[model samples]
Structure formats: structure tokens, C-alpha cells
Target: MSVESGGGTQAVERAMSLLVCFTDEHSELRISELCARTGLVQSTVSRMVSSLDRQGFLEQDERTGLYRLGPMAVTLGSIALNSNPLYRASRQSAQNLSQTTGLGVNLAELRDDRLFYLANFEGAKSPKSFTMAGRTAPLHATGMGKAILAELGDDYVRDYFTKGLVDAYTPHTIVDAATMERALQEIRNRGYATEVEELAFGRACIAAPIRGRSGRVVAALSMSGPLSELGLQGRQEELALTVIETADEISVALGFTVTRAPARRTTTAPKETAR
Candidate 1:
């Protein structure tokens, strides 16, 4: 490459590397931390961060002298989701599912080995609800996360589990890798995933994968509720079917052709029983 080309490539690399320094664990960082993580000179890091800040990609805290992702990044991400046909098609279906099931409905996508909630609808009868939009949840412990993982295959699942430490958010949280793998396998075999008080006590959820035109799973649609209602044996099955059918309808609306044959696993096999 020419000198100018090499300089431009290096600058792009440095900018991206700096952006990667922010993580869930360290959502905010100081200039010294950025310099250490990116291995760039303090002056260069300062200049680059200032440029990013001006573009609204980063925001510096006046009180703490720390930097975090800015509102511009959130605005851009929201724009991308709103512009997607899948998101647009799924909105009404999600609302319908929430209304029909009397449970909170959530739409999410797998990113960075976690489920990122994109949209949510609250049920009419839900007493207490948790809002998860723009939040990330563990893959092994959430119905939406597990549904996405089931579609991504084993290698991706392994890499994901290896990167993060599993925590027992509730007594029912599956923290063992082998057991979690078995759960994912069952989710793949069947067509839906379930979480019974895995993420939080007394909360349960069922989710199904939302496929794209190429038959690749791009997102998940879930119905979540308190255990008192969804925990009943027959009620859970009814809710699971509702979630699956709703997701399928939304996928079709997004122009996803379901060309693959269904898996051989029994749809009646309760995921909660498997656990």
C-alpha cells in the first residue's frame, strides 16, 4: 500500500480499537484506561476520543472524568432497528402475542454472545413487569437468549460460553456448561426455548426464533410472565405454541420463506420437564 493508504488504514483500525474498549463490565473508562487498552499514545488517544466525542460516538463525564458510549450511538442503533423490515413486521405480532397471552412480549437479537432486547410490549393483566429493551441478558439463562443460541449452532455456543462466566441469577439458573449445552440442544430439536425462573425468581418465559429470508435465525420473540400463571403445566404449553406461531407469522411477513423441514423432536415434550 502507498504511504497515504497505510496511514488511512491504521487510523481506521485505531478508531475501531478504541471503540471496542467499552464493554458491559467496564461501561465507562478513563483516558488512561483507553490508552492502556488500545496501546495508543496518550496524545493520540486524546485526539481520537475528542473527535469521536464531537461525532457523538463517545461522551465524557464532567464529574468523574470517565468516558462512555453517547446518545448518538443509541440513536443510530435505534434507527437501524426501526429501518429493518423484520422489526417492522414483528411489532404488531408481538403486540398481539402480548395481548393474547396476557404476558409481556419482547423481541431481541443475539449480539456479542448476549441477547439484546430491541422491543417490548406489556400485557394487560400483568401485575408486575420488567422492561428489557436496550439491555443484554445471559444466553444460557433466558428464553430469548437460548432460542437465538439454538439457531446459531454448537461452535458459536461454545465460543459464547467460553467468553463469559455464568452466574446463577436465580435458584433455577443453569450455570453448568454441559447442562446448558443439553438445554440448547433440546431447544434446537424442538423449535422453542423456555426459562422458568432462570433469570429472576418467579418469572418464566418462552421464546421462538425469528428466521430471515435465508432461513438463518436473526432474532427471537418471547412471552414472559409470572410463574403463578405461566408455570402451570398446560398453560405453559399453550403459551409456547402461541409464541412459536406468532414468530412464524412475523417471519413470513418479513419475507422469510420457511423451506427447512421441521426437526423430529416431539413438540409436546415440555422444556421445563427436560430441566
Candidate 2:
């Protein structure tokens, strides 16, 4: 590429990193905080922040001197979410599932080997303490993550382990390749994945893969709640079936045709059966 184009690309990347540093947990930050999060010098961050502020992508509080996402960012975020095919396909079904079951519904996609929550709908019975829409979670410790893992290639899975399973989030979180492999196999066999206090101490979730028109596991849908309320021991089968059906419905809406018979697979990649 030409030097001018390359320089422009790098600037764009730096700006994006700065924006990403402002997540749900860190909604506002000072220039120093942005520097710490992004490893960029103060001068660079300051320049970028000023440019972004001028463009309405960020705004600075005059009194507190902290920067936060501005009106343009909100407009762009809404447009992007509404235009996303997975979010569009899953939103209504996710809401309906949460309303019907009184269980929190989550839709997530695997990005950079981590599960990025696209939508989180809280049920009437769900705790209203936190929102997960802009959050990310480890692929080795959550139901939705494991469901997607079950559809990935074995070589990819092995390479993923080289990055180190994130430190265990709870006593039940899978921290070893051997154990996680077994869990993936179980998910493949049962057509779903489940996590009990693996990601959080008191939460549990059941998830199933959502396929695209090309028959690829592009994302996952899940239902989550407290362990005692979900009652895994008593209703595991019923809850699993419910999640699987809802995921399949979203898959169909995304243009994946249903097939009565599915092909057997020997590895972790998606099954080669017709959709």
C-alpha cells in the first residue's frame, strides 16, 4: 500500500482503539486513562480525542475533564446494531423467549475467540443489577461460548488454547484443554451446551448454536438465570430443548433450511449436513 494510505489506516485504527476503550464498565475516562488502556502517548491520545470531539464521536466534560461517547457515537451505534443481520434475526425471538420463560435471554457472537454479547434481554424474573450488551466473556467459561466452540475446528481450538484459557472465573470454570474438549463433545452430542456457576458463582445458562444460511455456526442464543431458579437437575432437558428450538428458529429466519436428518461429524467443526 502507499505510505499515505497506510498512515491513514493506522490513524483510523488508533482512533478505533481509543473508542473501544470506552466500554460499558468504563463509560468515561480522562486522557491519562485512555493512554493507560491503549498504550498510546498523551500527545497522540490528546490529538485523537480532540479530533473525535470535534467530529461528535466523543465529548469532554468541561468541569470533570473526562471524555465520553457523544451524540454521533450513539447514532452510529444504533445504526450498526439495527443493520447487523444476527442482531436483527435474533432480537424478537430472544425477547419472546425471555418473556415466555421468565429467564434472561442473550445473543452473542464469537469475535477474536471471545463471546461478544450482541443483545441481552432481561426477563421479569431476572435480576436488574447489570447489563451485558457491550460486554465480552471468555469462551471457555460460558454456555454460549462453549456452544460456539463445539462448532469450531480442532486445529483452531488447539491454537486457541495456546493463548491461555483465561483464569478461572469460578470453581466450576473449565481451565484445561482436556476438560474443555470433553465439554465440547458433550455439547455436540446433546445439541446444546450448559454452564452451572462456571462463568458466575450463582448463575447458570443453557445455549445452542445458531447457524447461518451457509450452515455455519455464526452465533449462539442462550437463556440464563440463577442456579436455584433454573433448576438444572430437574429441568435440564426441558430447558435445553427450549433453547435449541429457539436457536433453530432464529437460524431458519436467517435463511437456513431445516433438514430432518443430520450428518455425523468426527471433529469439532460444524457438521457437514445440509441445513
Candidate 3:
């Protein structure tokens, strides 16, 4: 490669490396931190950070001398989000579910073995769940994450487990690999995932996978509420059925067709009592 071309490539890589240094845990970073993490010289890191600030990929706090991801990053993310059919379809479904169920609803995608909450809704009269867009939850501890894991099938889930991605978040969390494997199988058979204070001490959730036009799970939709009300043994099955039904509607909107064989049945009610 020509010297100029190679230099340009290295500069872009350095800039991206600096940008990635700002994450949810580290929303802002100093030059020294960036240099340490990226393993780049302080001068190179500073220059790249400055260039990225000018380009709006990052912004610097003049007083603190720290850099954070900027508006352009949100703009780019908006562009990508607006183009996703699942987001568009699931947003409305999530809103409707929250309104109808009077509970908090979440729309999320599994990314890098974690559930990245894309949108959240709280019903007008419902107590709010502690969640919001851009928040993340562990795959092995949340309903939506488990729903996506189940949709990903055993091979993928096992491979991901082999990477040691599963973590216990609460006393109710299922961390044993074999037990979780059986739980995922049950989720698939039942067409939804359920959580009983798995992620939080007194909260429960039911989640179902949303499929895409390709008939593969692209995301998950979930409803969450208090353990006392939503986690009653009798209510879990009912709520799971409701969530799965709604998820099926979203999947159809996204182009997944139910493949059940057609059957005809006649409903015979005892002739209205001739009273």
C-alpha cells in the first residue's frame, strides 16, 4: 500500500478505537485512559480524539478534559434504528401491550450475548420498572434475553454458554448450564420465556421472540411487573399466553407465517336453556 493510504487507514482505526473507549460503563474518558486502553501513544490518542471531536463523533468537556460520544453518534444510531423493520413494528406492539396490560414493556435485541433495550414503555397507571433505552440486561437472567436465546436454538446457545457468558444476577437466576438448557427447550416448546424475579428481587417478566422477514428471531418483546401480582403461579401461564399472542402478531407483521396444519372444529353449545 502507498504511504498516504496506509496512514489514512491507521488514522481511521485509531479514531474508532478512541471512540469505542467511551461505553455505557465509561461514558467519558480522559486522554490518559484512552491511551492506556487503546495502547496508543498519548500524543496520537490526543490528536485522534481532537479530530473525532471536530467531526462530531465525540465531544470534549473543556473543564474536565474528558471526551464522550456526541450527537452525531446518536444521529447515526437513529438512522440505523429507523431502518430496522423490527424496531418499527415492535414499537407499536410494545406501546399497545403496555397500554393493555397496564405494565411496563420493553423491546430489545440480543447483541454480543446481552439484551440491549431499544425502547421501553410504562403504562399510565402502572408502577414503572427500572429500565430505559440503551440499558442492558444479562442474557441468562432476563425474560427477553432468554426468549432470544431460545430462538437462537440449542447449538448457538450452547456455543455461547461455552464462552462463559452466563452469569447469575439474583437468587432466582438459573446459572447451571444443564438446567438452563432444559429451560430454554421449555421456552421453545411453550413459545415464550418467563422470569420469576430472576433479574431483580421482586419483579417478573414474560417475553416472546419477534421474528423477521427471514423467519428468524430478530428481537424480543417483554412485559414486566411486580412479582406479587405478575408472578402468581396462576398468572404466569395466562400472561405468557398473552405475550406470545402479541409476539405472534408482531412476527406476522414482520413476515413470519404460522405453519400449523389447518383443521376444522365445530363448537356445539348446549341449546340455550329454554328458560
Candidate 4:
């Protein structure tokens, strides 16, 4: 009986792993592609795919044999999003920020060393038919990613680039470790970060880290737009301040209380020590 139970558990895990193989970029995939992604034998993958299809976790395209997520997956995703406290806390604030600024507002959390967008509100000035709610961006290439990285320790940040930065999405991307380190330090000092045409040409963003009640960085908030707009010569500081304030609002909503540093008492330097 114990052996049978263990086998059943293994089967369930494999089936879940198969489901996880589908993503925004690879939403529709063939069984062979699934095998390559999951490294499972064709027979095992085929059986599990069939089971998933029947259970409404996956649906196959009858004409192309490509499989895509089924309704059950969508239902579960909705439930998960609705249940997330961070998402709930930031949704309205993100909406308001986007509406007021006419710039995209994004909320994302760090996952697997990448920024995974949980919600996005497109500005009225730049409406899009789709959203980035379920997409991931590299940690080294986005404002939110940099803002979150600024909250991490120096040792961790150093180790993060030990393998060196990967994927330069645009010519302006910071590819060298020294440059990235300096940028993160600036973010730490300013309480916000900026991305100037790093992820895509003509695009820029300002972002700030969000902390939870535990005083740990839990996510980041950002305002994104065309470089011509967000990168305006005189308005960068204003936009950055707005982004930081909004992010702090979200952090407070998440129960984080700002801990102000004690003011330093300045004393006039001792009379010149001319012995």
C-alpha cells in the first residue's frame, strides 16, 4: 500500500510539472516540446498530457495537436490572484497612479532572480489591448528589478553578478558589473531607481521597492513610458518622486511602517587644533 501511495504521489508531481511547462511565451506547445521542456520520456508525458486534457487543465488544438492551457487553469489563476494580499493591496493604487500620470504602472515580485509582474495598468495615453500581468523580466534590465536589487545586501548583489549579466535587451543596458553596482548604490541612496531605454529603445521607467510588515522587500512598483516622456530633462526627479511615494503607499498598505533614522546632532568642529 505504501509503495502504491508513493507511486501516486510521483504521478501527481509529474502531472503538475507538465502543467508548469506552459508559459506566456510558450502558451501553446506540442507533446514533443513538452517532453523537451520537462525532460520526461515521451510515453510518460503523453499519458500525463492525456490525463490533463481530460481534467480540463490542458486543451489540445485538434488541427495542430498543439496544447494550451484550459479553462481550469484560468480559473485557478484567477483564484490565486484574487487571494494574493499584495495584489489586493496594490490594485487600486496602481490603477489610480496610471490614471493620474498617464503612464503605465506595474507591480511585480522577485521570483527566481527575475521580476514577475503581478499586475499592470496601462495609461490612458498609451493603452494596450493586452497586459504584462503574467510576464517576467530580467533582474538587470528593468526599473523594478533594480529597485528590488537595491534592497538586497552587497554580498548577495555581488554574487548575483558572479556569472556576469545576461541578455542585453538594448544597447543602453548596463552589462558591466561595476556599472550595475554603482547604479544599485544610487538607487539605495535615492530610494528609487530608473531605467533609461535599457529594456527597449525609446522606453524608460522609474521605480521603487515595496516592503512588507516584516520590513523586508516584497515587491516593486514602477511607472513606465516612452523615453521622450518619462526621461524628459527636467521632469525625471518629479516622476521618480511620484513613483517612490506611490510605492511607499503600497508598502504602507501592506503594513510596513517607515522607520525614520534618528537625526544626527551637528556640533561645530573643535577650535582649530593649532597646538
Best-matching candidate per TM-score: 4
Query: What is the C-alpha lDDT profile of model 2 across 1-275, one tens digit per residue?
Result: 99999999999999999999987778999999999999999999999999999999999998999999999987987888899999999999999999999999999999988999889999877766777875789888889998899899777778778887567887787787777787787778778888888878888888889999989999999999988778877777788778888998899999998776453222232331200
Error of 2 at 145 (Å): 1.0
In the range 28-68, model 3's lDDT, one tens digit per residue, is: 98889998999999988877778888889899888997889
Residue 35 miss distance in model 1 (angstroms): 2.7
Against the reference, the lDDT scores of all candidates come to 0.81, 0.85, 0.77, 0.82
Better of 1 and 4 by TM-score: 4
RMSD of each: 4.4, 5.3, 7.3, 7.1
Ranking by TM-score: 4, 2, 3, 1
lDDT of 4: 0.82
Evaluation by lDDT, superior candidate among 1 and 2:
2
lDDT of candidate 4 over 24-92, digit per residue (tens): 778899989999998999999999999999989999998998999999988988898899999999999
Q: Candidate 2 lDDT (Cα, whole model)?
A: 0.85
Alpha carbon lDDT at 7, candidate 4:
100
* Pairs that collide, model 2: none
Model 3 vs truth, CA RMSD: 7.3
